[model samples]
Target chain A: MSRETILASIRAALPPGQALPELDNFGLHYDDPIQQFITTAEAVGANLQSVDNRGGIAAAVQAFLPGASSILSHVPEVPCKNFTRDADRDPHAYSDLDLIVVEGLIPVAENAAIWVPDSQYDDHAAMVLTQHQVIIVRASDLVDHMHQAYAKVAAAEVPRFGFFLSGPTKTADIEQSLVLGAQGTRSLLIIMIRDESTSTI
Target chain B: MIDHAQHARNFTANAERTAWHDDALWFVREKRDKATKLIPEWEELREQASQVKMHMLSRLDHYLEEFERNATARGIQVHWAEDADAHNRIVHAILERKGVKNIVKSKSMLTEECHLNPYLAERGMDVIDTDLGERIVQMRNEPPSHLVMPAIHIKKAEIGDLFHEQLGTDAGADDPKYLTEAARQHLRPKYLEADAGITGVNFAIADTGGIVVCTNEGNADLGTSLPPIQIHCMGMEKLLPRLEHLGVFTRLLARSATGQPITTFTSHFHGPKPGGEMHVVIVNNGRSAILAKPEFRRSLSCIRCAACLNTCPIYRRSGGYSYGSVVPGPIGSVLSPAMDLEKYAALPFASTLCGSCTDVCPVKIDLHDQLLAWRKYVVKEGYLDKGKARQMKMAGKLLSSPTLYRTASFLSKGMKLVPRVLLYNKKNKWGMERELPLPAKRRFRDLYRKRPRS
Candidate 1:
């Protein structure tokens, strides 16, 4: 079915009021909220310029796409995953412009290191990320964040320890005391872009 | 009973616990990928397993009958439950016959679906969950957020607290190893003393008239091996045509569900350990309803692999409990509404329709598309609120014609003050969070006109 019909059918299928409070207009997302919520949340604010990695939105974003890896990171170490310009990406979903930057390009300074949960390989990505703000999220930490982000938005409210994931990480080798974030990034990094655009001030 | 909105709020909170939850599960997902990548037949395996499930779903009633017949010949008593209440009572009645007040249960989503423990508790029976994760959640007085990993939402520190309070651990003793030993010591006695064991069927073989239970920790083995009376609760959809399908399914099941090369254990029980009593309850709460409809028939194809749950973006953000169903996440979003639309109507809309769940599913349930179809059913039932219905009808009328749509757009964008009251309908989700952005002066088509075509 067409996106409109799929949405119409879904909207039609909802038991009314249950579709509670949706984006004013549904475009490509099939009127699904999870996408709208996450991608939009990720959109945060665009850089005033083209810079997506560091400088300005214009220069940064441009450097990150279309033979993105071909454009070297301002930081030398962080490995840049090949970037593709996904113009069709839903604003509510993670954009196609994911750049797996080298881990060590910018290291977490002593004071701010506390906030960022460490990434799995600290020493390897360490050199490239020192100057830049870094979030060392582990596989487990990402899961926790996803849980927290969904809960944070959906409830239209937030709760403490809201992002902790409980189950899959728990091992019953001896007895099953579930440990979350054990094998993952324990801290998150909020990289402060020098040239602000849409990001929180 | 909570309102759908409140339950939805709770679900959102629970589901958020899963956003990273999906990412976390992705390791296992990645692991499955790593394993699948090595083999050229990975996609083929998914197809064969899906077809097996398709055949089973189509003739669920028939295979179930065959299972009952074979199991009965093997000296097992079979019961059927039409709903949760019936399912619970069947177990209760069996326990009452055995005069057992306590029982051990191994990882059964069906029991969770039935709410068996709480139901039995009210009737004076103490139902103990034997699966390690289930045990932890039960001790904490919380529902299992994820089916396979019962205590996934619980942290080790929190578990330390739970164990400290219940099992007498030192305060702040948060070692996973130490805590597990404590639980093992605690549950061992319960395993030996329990009168009956309840296990969920991972796969039930119709030909052998046997039931299979898969687990990593071997909790199900202890539950069934020790208990004199074993009660296996299975959904009608858990059947496989022949026993050989086990090799393919067993290969994919754990790998897909938990990223393990194989679940630590896969045990098949023909019926009663020689002399013990065996009972199988094939519950069909809403399978028939879904099967009757073509769009949703494929949902029954799910192997409960949870690959969809692990990969779903919405499920990742929101943990399972937010769903307010025995099973949560993408699978529950579709099935819950199918089982009870009034109760779960909001679920389908909870998704962004990313199609990730469909992609990860080994059985290929077409979850996103079914959700799209279900949306039509919910609306066609006229269950919509009149005011919103009127609003939608008005919007529909305007959008049906381009000229009217343009006029409405121009007025909203150009007028600036169309009365937030009128332009920003507070009752809508748009107004609930942020005001809708006014339209740009020109449309994309107009912009295309300005710039030469590529």
Candidate 2:
């Protein structure tokens, strides 16, 4: 079998096993994760908005994307034309979505990434198909770097597929010229809710 | 096939294009420098990443078994391939079982190394490259120039023309935004229609049995999520012992490759979603041979960030195609020689030994030192050019003897008076682009003897 052959080759080539290094402190920490996350997110080309309650998500989305019309979302308070959870539709049905608002489980400060799992949003196609994306995270869920983020996920029952969404999709393929919104969402609005008891909704 | 110097010479024939290419890569290098400077613990992070890879390499077998156990327990099929041919066959079998004719693939250099596209294409299958840069190069019928930025060598106008011809974009649309949107419209349907999706693993976490894929575009995620079958291909070296170690690598990969804080998407796949089948193909492909050699073994730690390519002076001017390898740069110079010593004997000599590639490597591969070592190995294997070997031997003998060296120096000084005809011809390869230096009249030994004692 190829498996046995490959494993034998690896065993023959490998040296004796060595102890793994300590990696808990590999990531950098910030004095204020929220401020740092906001600064880093904006630097990576994401518009930021802050709110105190869940109701403010609608206001923030409207303010961020005033011209948005074809909205599809799963967040309870966000305004949308269609809810992906309402029906058993194909992922491609939301191909022309103008805006998608989903809740992020955790906010990482080092790179401004927010963890969004498949369980949080059933139709992940909305994350990539929409013209604009808004990911809401509780301020209390913010961490300093990826180390803490991974620790949290490992501690919790993270689903089969989870992704860290940092900013809007971008590309620089044309002579290294920076261009946002190549194939995915063009604009990203990261909203941080200050309320401590912000539900998964 | 082993004429790297001649290839580089032809590449630099267009002086304007050479300068532009050099400046373009330098711009990327500068961006990397700026981004790295932002993180105060960047060096420490690189060292930590290196140590993590070192530990994984030593215990690779154990981790592979562990990963396979967990992955299989989660209903994920894990296939092992001893070489490129086996890897292609495994992928083909999986696709053939599903009767998949069309596939959407994200950027995976491993697949390129395996020649999977053509292997499937010859069998009447269509492999659609989904990454914007990869799609651009695929349409042009060329291999990727840069690892992260696949179409970096092509001009915007060329891409515009290609898209206009193939994707029906406006003929004069050279704008990057317009071209990207055109590709999006073209690929959206293909993503949904593809029977399976193939992606390369950035890091295979043993603890979680998860493969992490980082892409600025959500192409990998979109392809995998939409398809019923997800086939992830990875080299044996792409493993980390723990899930927490991902923080260290994720911080360094994007910043080193494209100066971004992070890619827009860093997705982790532990297993297939509901009703979906996930297949993980682990490929050796000469990685075991590389691992056995102590000097070149550090190369296995590479994360495919292509930071070395951006920092390499030789790579910028000569272009990626000049190296005649799928991966073409300082790392390529070291890697290609190991893969085919006789065919790629000239690659190790393509570099200037500037050590810039070594400095920028996220995993600290010791690239320049490896290049020098490959040169020594190539010569030891009797692959050196006959004339160059003779010149080096003669110089070595004369330099070992003071009298003979002085005589040779004296003769060289007198040869300045010889006609330019003898020195400027094609036989004198050194004089083709550079003039020979005028020899000094007096030797350093002679001048020192005549000087007054201090």
Tens digits of lDDT, candidate 2, B77-174 = 99999989999999999999989988999999999999999999999889999999999999988999888889888889998999999999998789
Q: What do the candidate models score in CA lDDT, each in turn? A: 0.58, 0.88
Candidate 1 lDDT, tens digit per residue, A93-131?
221223322221111110011111112222211211111
List each candidate's DockQ score: 0.02, 0.75
- Model 1 stretches with alpha carbons more than 4 Å out: A1-201, B1-32, B385-391, B409-425, B431-442, B447-454
Assess chain B of each prediction and give its TM-score.
0.89, 0.97
> Which parts of model 2 have CA positions greater than 4 angstroms off?
A24-27, A84-88, A195-201, B439-443, B447-454
The CAPRI quality class of candidate 2 comes to medium
> Model 2, A144-173: lDDT tens per residue?
887788888888765788999988888888
In model 2, what lDDT does residue A6 have?
Answer: 83
Query: Which pairs of residues collide in model 2?
Result: none
